[model samples]
Target: MNLKRINIPSRLKGLCYTLVIIISFNMIAPIAFAETTFEVSAKAAIAIDADTGKIFYEKNANTPLPIASMTKLLTLYLILEAEKNGQISWDEQIEISDHLLKISEDLNLSNVKLVKGSSYSVRDLFNASAIISANAAVTALAERVAGTEKDFIDLMRAKVISWGIEDAYLISTSGINNEDAQGRIYPGSKENEENLMSAKDMALVAQHLLQDFPEFLETTKLPSTVFAAGTDEETVLESSNFMLPGFYYYKEGVDGLKTGTTDLAGASFAGTINKNGLRLITIVMNANDSNGDGGLRFVETTRLMDFVYENWTYETLYPKGSTLPGFNKIDVPNGVDLSVPIITNDPLQLWHRQDMNKEHLTLTMVNSYEALDKNNQLKAPVERGQQVGELQVGYPEDTLGYVDGSKQKTSVPMVTNGATKKANFFVLSSRSIKNFFSTIF
Candidate 1:
């Protein structure tokens, strides 16, 4: 039998080679592709370090989806901020406006009924909103904080923008659909439009709330509280978060975050936990509960959390005194020494996954060299262990990325390990004269 020889096009051959290499790489190191390895059932999901805002895993986290009552998280944030700024006191009494009373009386919505002519303390309204996801309580707080719910919506927009989030669409203080706002919708948003935010945005809001006003957790952890105890309008407010201490889906370290659900936003959760000092925040949106039990979001959150706890650990990625290959030193022109060695000032401790390929990690120098010369060289008289700049630790496959979207990676201080002494006046003069001539030429 005669075998016929065939000629392959160069482009096709190169493509074939690339495919083979990719296949070989995948087979050889499946652990490196951590992003694609795990899966969570949700429209958008994310897991992050609550303290550092370092993202560990995410699925469709950047896409803005209906966040439902999670809108209240922002409302809660503004309320706490107002209290901190002395704009409102926790015990300040707010009268039930007819507009808010109308929403509160709606038995269909999650709310604590407010008597038409009654007043409730800010603490009561905050408790109702945080514990039970009460729409009217949140609306009342919004009105009190900004003099109107619409202005509060504007504040929410401004707050998210200040945090580097641009995709958040706000319409209701309670995260209710605009159509469900009962003629009390935000000015510009169209009717029927629900509040939409990316999972990352929700995480960012939660991070700010937890980091800035940690005391808010005091109310959020409540399993049950009375809205207006010993009063006619009194109602029991039970936390919607099933993962709290007393709930069936309870996880040990879980505490104080928020949960949201609506027709538009199926069931979403922004849950946080601090286990052994390593705090984590996980956001899951649009989770499905086939049996209509509303526990699916919790289940998905648990899965995501378990994945993180099992796979990731708090450890040093790069130790102190270590130097990166390319960014290990800086040229010190006009110095006794031509160059100065640089090393990490502190250990780069981060929540990193186990068995991850270290080859995928990279350290890039942050360009904050104020002391650099015209040629990007450090000026003389460098002190030992002087901070020249920062080195950003990077992982390109992190699809969900940091909560602060503008930052590409977590940064660590990069400092000089050895001092670069200033050169003598004669040498400096010679160098300056040579540079002047070179510039002219």
Candidate 2:
């Protein structure tokens, strides 16, 4: 067909081309989606809710492996316990023993040089061990506390067993690789034994330490501090935990815990963070320097903390003294009132994913009466604030699948809000007669 030539305006042609490009981009561009999964370079790792022994995430957390200087955390625990029990004082002076002096002289191990005749306070030794992971300082403290490192190891093993940590085996007060000493282990030490622990067990140890001696954080959280200040032999000890201030990979919430490194353990960290009253503990073992810049433990720990804080949060689901939604009243036989009001004795705080649906959460009431009788029934003469049952809150198993026991459910005591008395037999009979006449009518 023959067609007449038509001229189009330049601006109109540009507008038409712009519209076509916008439409094509909209059609072909990838849709953005929220990140729900994460990966780390560590061989074994775990994240736990500090308040509750809840495991939020885990990867080979039960695999036994070398934990390096993280073993010092246990040593720190015993020292604090000793001090608490009046076994040792923080200001008590300890002379530099020959063993400690020898260990300090060895440049191959991390140490704070100790003058053979110089005496230091228990506080000094604790700061050196906690902040800088000084093996010599920690060993000296262990010797002071239990009379020998071997005895200290026995105490450590006993304490771990008491805490129900079965898989852990303690061979040293400090987590030094026994093999690194050219096959010459310390005197009284097993030839081939090394401190081996799983991430879960390590987290448990951390939990116990924090619960028993929260003051230890004062030493671990310091980015830099003086060990023997104002003396001619002054030394400055810096924290190896990079999550602390002034170091690379320093996160805002990380406060204390421990770090370990050895040929076998690689870079391992047991770190704790407090953000807006929500505390978390994370353990990363056998992590390597992915970029060869060092601080692989810190890098992985920071990543895990970032993921957790981004996805999980603590929420108070049920407040104390508030009546349960469906269990507001309980039957009271022969009482002044036919029923009495009941409520939770304490608030229920749960650590859950940020995107979790609060409405889907379930509450399981475990009656205290079940312990007394096979029939789940409470007797009259109930007193205010008397615990009658327990409230367990969590998502259904079908919804969240299998979750860690800590994160699975939060339990709180359910109690009565007011007293109820049993009515006399005559009053009960009169009420029954009136109820029978009303029913007949």
Candidate 3:
């Protein structure tokens, strides 16, 4: 074949080339992020509704495993509480302890070298621990809070137990192995012990931290910050959570959470995201990364995110002042009115899956009556908005339940919709006489 070629202007050729490149990129960008089949390789994982404690998904979530730096979340919780309760202040300056200084100087750990006799504010230490996962910075804060790291571990144990986590195995304050603590292990604990918690337990910790301290995201969302800013020892601290904005694995709506890695723990993450007003907390523990890049945790967490957003939606299941079928009105025989209408005190909002049938959701009236007569009727006068009992929303039989492994029901208070004044004495006496005569007949 023979063809004649015509030369084009240089400027026109460059413009054509640019347009082609832009068109090609636009075509490929959407495909790169399109969803595909995904499987989680983590030993344990869980995704939960941050506000409602609803479990959206789980895999081997109850088994205990090492959590690495994710343990700092609990430490941060205590520090915030201490500050709120007047035990500590963000501006309070703490003198560097020799023990923490040595750990800070160790090159093997994640830390910023602390100068002996130097003082740092609580805010700086917190930012370093949170943003950089600096172990010694957190350990210093732990010591300052509880007077000793061992005592802080005790406090951590007590706190988790109070949250209904019975199987937490805590050793060091920073989630490092006891051996890494330089012979400063917790009393009676083995040298190799590292902080171990099931995915559920970690989810509970994340849940509590986010719920109790919504302001925490203010610090966790910072991609980079200067520790000891405007000082001679100023150091830059970058977040280990790559899912935040402006990172390689960045996902929109991902703000504050924690990441962990160790020899025993592989790589793990406790991630949270707020999408369209619905916030979810996810935990992936011991994720295997063949590339050894420690990014598999974020990848697995993204899978959990996909599972939730693709399969579930957050909406109001029931409106306020609505009552369950057949249980709408409670018997109040002796009041001015014979019976009183009852309803939910608030709206019932929860996470729902795409394939889930609304008809399958069941509401059961819990037996928690405050005051009842012999026949189960309200004893007398009932006040408006008085809580009569609880209404529990039941999920499917095969559901995995909550991250905490507690009951799967989403409970709301059932209350009287209006007040019922006591009946007059004459009316009560007449009703009693009529009841007695009818019984005799």
Candidate 4:
């Protein structure tokens, strides 16, 4: 082979062009296809629908596990709620304390460099905490909520319990590791004070968040963000979730959720995607390869979500009001004769079962119609859903959905509606006698 010397500018141009092609190729081929399931060995992991707390897949779902900065969800929840309750105004300015001021100085960390005595609007602080996972921003929020981080954490616990998050513990506002075993602090205290949550509990937290703090969805969907750059040198926050664009499962509906990382917790992620009308939330914890890469978390999230979307198709079980024939309709003596609207308050959730065929059913109706008074308790021992009406609807033995199959009776939940009627002595005596006999019958 003969070697010829090339011009400097031309050689440089050719090298640059070749490098661009190589980079493009690598970027284009981000991840490969793999069989999807919930086979991850994470300490705890779960995937659910944010709108509906449907658990698509889970591993160690009820077991408590260390969650890194994903603790921000709780912090974010309290702050947003406080804002909603008029406790704090988004435009209101507030000063930072020593706790937040110190955290802002941590290098390469998500800090807005908020200065002491330098005031910021609640919105700014809110974005900083949520968008960047700024430790200082959340700590400041904690202080505002309950006068101190310790007390604020108690408030957070109360809120979590209200949302049904059992077994999850929040020790730090930012979920950063700290070794201080102070009595007042929540359990994340021994250089291991990351937020602790299980897949099931986290799902509960997420469900509550979606119901109340839906604005969080807007912030997390951003692939990148620019915050406080003018004041604090304009810190740019690129999303740590790389699966946003150009991924198979990732589409226009992918929005913001929390991500986590720690030596103990590994790379953790809780992400959500809304496609068409179906929305799915995915969680992965403790899937590290010792390479400092978030590959396992990414791969697991993708696999699990893909499995759920592909394997399980949401089917309509029993719809509202549509009656099962062969049942006698009671004559409404005074009220209008309309078929009492029979429906499930919530959809019947099923996994790995898909039969949807109709079968024989038996519906037992009890007279919840009592003298409706006050906020209208039925003035009886029976509560709202204590079988006032039951439809022993036939269900399938096994199917993708839990709809009726081979003539098996499934109890349906029906609630009583308050009545508006003039309660005279005769009406009261007749109803009381009817109720006593009905109970016995």
Task: Compare the candidates by lDDT and give the number of the best one.
Answer: 3
Off by over 4 Å in 3: 1-39, 321-324, 328-345, 348-350, 379-388, 412-441
Candidate numbers sorted by lDDT from highest down: 3, 1, 2, 4
Model 3 shows how many backbone clashes?
Answer: 0
**Tens digit per residue, CA lDDT, model 1, 156-178:** 99999999889888878898887
lDDT of 3 by residue, 123-159 (tens): 9999989888889999989999999998999999999
Q: What's the TM-score of each model vs. the native? A: 0.84, 0.79, 0.80, 0.67
Number of clashing residue pairs in every model?
0, 1, 0, 15
Q: Write the per-residue lDDT of candidate 2 for residues 1-441, one digit (tens) a residue.
A: 111111211111111110001112354554332334677679999887675666667788878899989999999999999999999998888998776687777787777899978888899999999988888899888889898777888899899888777788778888887754444364666765688999888988898888888888888889988877777779888888888888877889788889888778888999999876668899999898756544888888888887877877666665667876667877665677877888877766665675554545567666653322234446666778776666666753223222122333456666788897778889889988999999999
* Residue lDDT tens for model 4, 1-441: 111111111111111110001112244553332333348656678777565455556677777888877888888888888888889887887789866677788764556787777877777777777766777887887787789888887887788777656577777777776632223346445554667888677766766777787878787777767765467545676666666764443545567677787666778888777764667777888878667767777777777776666665544344443333433232233332222223443333223222222221123333333322233232332232322334333222221111111222233444433222334567667877998999999
Model 2 is weakest, by summed lDDT over 10 consecutive residues, at 12-21
Which residue segments of model 1 deviate by more than 4 Å?
Answer: 1-35, 232-234, 323-330, 366-368, 396-400, 425-441
TM-score of candidate 3 relative to the true fold = 0.80
Model 4's lDDT to the true fold?
0.60
